[model samples]
Target: MKKIAILNGPNLDRLGKREPEIYGHTTLADLEASLRAEFAATTSLDFFQSNHEGALIDKIAALADAKFDGIVINGAALTHTSVALRDALAGAHLPTVEVHISNIYKREEFRHTSLTAPVSLAVISGLGLEGYFAAVRFLLKR
Candidate 1:
């Protein structure tokens, strides 16, 4: 089976509750279940979510060392702020796709820039949970 890691950073664990107007009512667990059910037959999935930058960076390193085929990451608040996370992703050199529940382009000015985008295979934003599915499907095909 092809291995893919889905990494979520900062405030994403509050998916259903944090900002329902923008993030929707679906919890992270619900999203995971949806992804697992959709791709379980053909892909081996590893899901990790953290509020800490170091933990997420550590996961990127571990995934790279383990030779994961691809990654789907929603860096959340870290997307614009963490050069360390961006560096980790770049260093990993894994085929990575960045995801966002809301369109970062439509949000606050700071959210518009993503340090991780330059190193990713693609970035899927504004599609809600579908963005996650899209990222996984794109990676699976790649």
Candidate 2:
């Protein structure tokens, strides 16, 4: 099985609760369950979520050290501001996909920019929870 790490940052833990209007009703746990159920046969998924930038960066380093095949990350608000997180992802040298539940471009002007996108193999936006699945599929095929 291919080993993949799913890392969520910042307000993502508030998925189903924080902004039901935009992020939808899918909880973090629900997303994990759905991904696992869909990719169980071929993928070994490890999920991690953190509100702290350091913790998420640490997790990325750990995943790289452990030789994970790929990463699916939704850096939440960090996507716009965290240079350290972007560096961690680039430094990890693992195939990565950045996901956003809502269209960042459609939101605030600040959300339009992603510091992590250049390091990611792909960026999936406006797809809601399906972005995670698409990222995993792309990584798995690669």
Instruction: List candidate 1 stretches off by more than 4 Å.
Output: none
**Candidate 2, residues 1-142: lDDT per residue as tens digits?**
8999999999888989996999998899999999999999999999999999999999999999999999999999999999999999999999999999999989999999999999999999999999999999999999
Least accurate stretch of 10 residues (summed lDDT) in model 1? 76-85
lDDT of 1 by residue, 15-108 (tens): 9999799999999999999999999999999999999999999999999999999999999989899999999999999999999999999989
The residue-level lDDT of candidate 2 at 74 comes to 94
**lDDT of all the models against the reference?**
0.95, 0.95
RMSD of 2: 0.6
Clash-forming residue pairs, model 1: none
Instruction: List ranges where model 2 is wrong by over 4 Å.
Output: none
